[model samples]
Target: MNKNKKVIEVKNLKKYFNVGPGLTLKAVDDLNFYIYEGETLGLVGESGCGKSTTGRTMIRLYDATAGEVLFEGKDVHKMSRAEHKDFTRHAQMIFQDPYASLNPRMTVGDIIGEGIDIHRIMGGKERMERIYNLLETVGLNREHASRFPHEFSGGQRQRIGIARALAIEPKFIVCDEPISALDVSIQAQVVNLLIELQRDMKLTYLFIAHDLSMVKHISDRVAVMYLGTMVELASSTELYDKPLHPYTQALLSAIPIPDPNIERSRQRVLLEGDVPSPINPSAGCRFKGRCRYAKDVCHQQMPELREVGPDHFVACHIV
Candidate 1:
């Protein structure tokens, strides 16, 4: 978490999908941030807000249209084939849908051992042993390795997915809404496993999720995104306790409190309209249409992310 060392640094990263010659969808636009070594940087936003796109772009699943992504101070996009394969071993992703991500035809043993085989890191007996250990680490029995995806529950399948990711001994992982498809009770278990594994392995994480409560619990810092742009970034406690941006304040106001007295006392700050379309977005702030305090300047000019406090940044005219 030290400022001096960044495992992954993203500078003005952009990802756009081409719909046609004159049309494009800006999924991630001008995002600038860095993930400190061995820390979880929680990326929270509404669906289609580009959180997933940002993660995918960083891993090169979708080639970024602009900006630079550096891993350990090396440019990720410029890596050679051999270096790319090495990069894959160090950086792995646990996708949101466990059932869809895992192969239905492959046994759990094969699923976990696939990375080892591709990397040529181990032989037959050692690879099988590692797969068994991974299954055990994720709270699944060794015998279950012979079973298919359908044999496991939603939570168990997720554990299998996690086992696969960990099989490669990755130093960093992008958890793309990993628990969004699981039951509420099961979510905690998966989250706890990630936290524990991170501690044991000293791993860094780009945890992209919509669950603010879970994000608050798991993240060392949180980045708030709106309509493909990052609006605010700050320490988890600072962001939750004293949000500076109007958009951030509005978002936090919507989270429900358990206590009846506190819940009744709180007033929800609803935005005025839906998120603006990203395809050739209007010049100005992406949130200009719904920002409560947007002024004339907000509609005509875009705001840059500027530091407001130590390790705290916000982008908005009102901020």
Candidate 2:
């Protein structure tokens, strides 16, 4: 956790789906980023902008149409059976929906111990002990292990999901909007638990969420995506203070400030036009339609992400 090591690296990652005989939907296109060991990299964008899809693709939930995902310097998609099993053991996911992700039929202990049994980590008393320990680790108790998922509240269900992900002792986890489905009162509790767990366990995370404020609170580095492509990436503090991309600026402007006077004085960047379709997208910049400062070049050529400031990268012709 103290060392600066990369846990995951993505290079020119593209995931496309064929909707019809001639139409193709680009869910993730040429995305390039890396997550350091013990650090949280936040991926934020509007819905359907491929935030969740990117997380799923990185974890091999969906096959890539092109490009490579390197987990600990090994290609995730190209791994053999043994390597894939090892990768699965080291990497786990906490899905967005707590209610849907957990199996209704299985007991809490069985659900949490499923990975332990699949990998044959332990059995009998030892395995039962492990399940009980996992439950306690996520703020639950052994008593809850005998119950089903329907018996728990939304926040408790998410905690159970967290326990399930940690059962195998994974190094990297894709937290795909883990707290999005929780009640507003319970959201902070879950986020705080995740933060504490990361500090205690020395875990790395790819936190994907549309909640920019929450992302800033948890992530070290933030990557902003728009229309299946990365628009900007920088340290959380730097990106929040000085965003370079139009989409990013608009997104930040939408966050409500606490002070009434300051909020009223602040200028909101209201974007014009609807988001362009990702299906068979045009040859130019995907954000050009909504960007007021877009020029002729933005319509003719797609912008590639370029380093603008120290550790700050942005993909925009004007920037």
CA RMSD of each candidate after superposition: 0.9, 0.9
Tens digits of per-residue lDDT for model 2 on 1-319? 5447899999999999999999999999999999999999999999999999999999999999999999999999999999999999999999999999999999999999999999999999999999999999889989999999999999999999999999999999999999999998899999999999999999999999999999999999999999999999999999999999999999999999989999989899998877788999999899988999999999999999999999999999999
Deviation from native of the Cα of residue 137 in model 2, angstroms: 1.2
Minimal lDDT window, size 10, model 2: 1-10
| Pairs clashing within candidate 2 | none
Task: Give the TM-score comparing model 2 with the true structure, all chains together.
Answer: 0.98
Give Cα-based local distance difference scores for all models: 0.93, 0.95
Q: For each predicted model, how many residue pairs clash, with residues at least 3 apart or on different chains? A: 0, 0
Instruction: Give lDDT tens digits, candidate 1, residues 194-225.
Output: 99999998889999999999999999999999
- Any idea how many clashes model 2 has? 0
After superposition, candidate 1 runs with Cα above 4 Å error: none
Error of 1 at 212 (Å): 0.3
